[model samples]
Target: MASELPMEEIVRRGARTNFEGLRESSFVPLFLTLWGRQASDDHVRQQLKRHYESVTDHLVGVYADFFESQGWDPRPPFTIRDFAVTLTALVEGLTVRWAVDPDAVPLEMRSVQSSMRVERQDDLDAGPWDLFGIVVLALIPSMTVPRIKRDSELWADHEDVRGLVRRLRETWESMVGLSPPAEAPDHTAPESADHCGAEPRRT
Candidate 1:
């Protein structure tokens, strides 16, 4: 379900859905305890361990594809697999917390706001942001860079305009996981007879 959705929706719905499922499932605690016990149930423990590792590996692949599709490169000291592992851990921890105290990790918590600049009116109109979504949003900046191509217009603009445009586009990418549609035009392709921005040669 998460893989089919856009990044923004994944951040919102993905985390919430996982938390809700884990918190409500009676099998989660049962499995955890069963895996931890040192009784003679070694076979059961090995099966559970393999299952957990398999799930983690699947998540790693999904996340790697998602990040690559969005043209985001990981920052130094972190890899795509690392982000996947972190996300898995985050959901697991949140589930435990929610199981302990539902009120503390409610589906709609107002106190926690992501540091990312909230998208304009669209996000506001979507209704209240949840704690899970906010945490996912906050994690984006530190882990990825907007390595996508810039718009051609950015190259033609003044320095300040270029900077502002770049920053805005980066924020946009972080929020929606989209990149500029086209790359900046090549300026060195043997200047045209009627240079771009130059007076029209009165032919």
Candidate 2:
């Protein structure tokens, strides 16, 4: 099914779902213990490795789809594959951490206390943000960059059109946690015409 949710929302939901499972599931630790014991048997260890690798492969595909949907590319610092691996490892580590010290890793953010304001009932039930969601949102900007379509033909030469495009690009960059550089890029430069409009977006 196609998701109408924005990239940030998708990341938030995915992270929270993982956090919920890690925190609430009773069988996870038991399964981990059983899986650990199987590591002593070479044949079982190989099978387990294959299973985990398959799961990682699935996560990679999910990330690929997410990036495509967002018109984003993996930034220079890391590849999409690297992100999938890191996220998987993070979940594993966080699962152990949560089990050991639930107090340290809370499921939701602490409520703000304001003496002047009365709490709304909806606010309590909304469940808008979580620690896992916050962490994922913070990492997204570093992990990916928006695909800026710079071909002159794709953009009209009119000042109004150009200004609108620039604003849109700025908004996109900001959404991904990027700060505008000291100098703005000259999108109209003739030498920069890359025939980008004709080419498929890079993942």
Candidate 3:
């Protein structure tokens, strides 16, 4: 049956169909799907550090596909590090008033010390910057990043996307807010002070 229809046609058909029962779908199947495709999935419990060294590309592709599949089109024009900053801003934006206080969203995780320095055994060397490069590995999966400018046609046409991201953000905002504000995009890479040492972007 699967072979009877072309893959793209099947996906389009699914898009048009009125199938039900997917509202409460779990994420395990999806994550396992990406991991299954990459033989070097070190996220497996107790993976040695060396395993990550060989699978960086696999991980990045897995995450990139995850984001694109979620309709986060028109990606930012910056390095993965910059993209991380933008993504963080988007996911953690919107400072709402606390349920009781008239001042602002209570900084629940801001004051009491919420592991300032999380140590990952593998640099797998992934850093905070990896957030932009790898959305799939977020502590929680999301379809959008808050605060980041989503393009002109967005604010009006993408209410569903906006609502999804807004709620995802609000849900997490009380827990741990987004890092940097979506003020502006950074064009240069931090390590590019020596641009004389590298090549240029094709675009």
Clash totals for all models, in order? 0, 0, 6
Residues 1-203 of candidate 2: C-alpha lDDT, one tens digit per residue: 26665455567678888878766878567758768878677776777678778878998898898888877777655688888878877776777787889777777665522321224454333345566677777677556666764464323223333454576688789799998778886768765335655565588
* Reference-based lDDT, residue 179, model 2: 85
Over the stretch 1-203, how does candidate 3's per-residue lDDT look in tens digits?
22333322333233222111121235334533555655665455224224333344443454455445544432223233333434333322311122234244322223322332334443222112211112222322233343444554333333544455565566676678655356686666466545667667676
Best by lDDT: 2
Cα lDDT for residue 196, model 3? Answer: 62
Worst 10 residues of 2 by lDDT: 111-120
Each model's lDDT comes to 0.67, 0.67, 0.36
Per-residue lDDT of 199 in model 2: 67
- Which residue pairs clash within candidate 2? none
Instruction: State the lDDT of candidate 1 residue by residue for 1-203, as single tens digits.
Output: 22444566556666667767777889778876886773668888788768778887898787777777766676545677777778777877778787788788767755544533235655333334567767877777656655753464333223333354576688788799886679888877888766767887685
Cα error, candidate 3, residue 169 (Å): 9.8
Stretches off by above 4 angstroms in model 3 are: 1-50, 73-138, 141-203
Provide the lDDT at 166 for model 1.
Answer: 71
- Every model's TM-score: 0.57, 0.58, 0.20
lDDT of 2: 0.67
- CA RMSD, predictions in order: 18.2, 15.3, 20.4
